[model samples]
Target: MNTRPIAAGLFDEGASPRLRGGRHRQTGRFVFPCPQGGERDSYDEVRLASTGTLWSWTIQRFRPKSPPYTGPEAFEPFALGYVALAGQTIVEARLTGMAFDAIRIGMALRLTTLPFATDPDGTTVLIYAFEPDGDRAS
Candidate 1:
């Protein structure tokens, strides 16, 4: 899918966000899907669109939770935390494409896609990430 820039200097890995749950779900819930479906439980992960501020973050100086979490475990640490999207929802994602010291509360951030890992069958997993807004390096 073609990624596009959205409001407040945010860019998603897809064109436009797919609003899930209509009005039944809480406002600000977003699901990023490909032009089609059939992967990773039908792409049901909630992602941010345009307006989010970095509420807070924590540096993961150790390995992540479990299988499928394919980030650095030994040498390089990663950041994990929540971003406050508009409408009173906080979305948690991996922080990328910037230095740890550079991250601060209220910094601008947007959705990103990074190569997660390769499955035993080599299917490859692409995951959602968040980086400084408008910086494509993320």
Candidate 2:
């Protein structure tokens, strides 16, 4: 089966995947998934850091409303969090590879991807996420 990122220009699929972010040309502020259309002109496209510290998190116990929630019909709870990319910006992403209770603020995390859903054509769509970084965690 073929695989693809959930959205174009969202992240790279190289040996080390990185989220595609944008740096404001004036303030140097960073934003994820890069801006589109006219807003694209004022920023420089950059790959985001692969590692970060978990800033905050919460458990998503119920299936989110549709139109945006495209997961499986049989809903399951999930963990989502904001990860601070050091001097860069904090990014909101799903947390994985650990139990919800194990997640901690300031815990080291690494960029990763998870299978979101399969397209009608059978292509597995992947979404960006953050996972515990065993090597860097205290």
Candidate 1, which ten residues in sequence have the lowest lDDT sum?
A: 17-26
> What lDDT would each prediction earn against the true structure?
0.56, 0.91
The segments of candidate 2 whose C-alpha lies over 4 angstroms from its true place after superposition are: none
Model 2 weakest 10-residue run by lDDT = 8-17
Q: Give the number of the best model, judged by TM-score.
A: 2
Q: Put down candidate 2 lDDT per residue, 8-68, tens digits, no spaces.
A: 8899975578999999999999998799999999999999999999999999999899978
Q: On a 0 to 100 scale, what is the lDDT of residue 103 in model 1?
A: 88
Candidate maximizing lDDT = 2
TM-score of 2: 0.96
TM of each candidate vs. truth: 0.60, 0.96
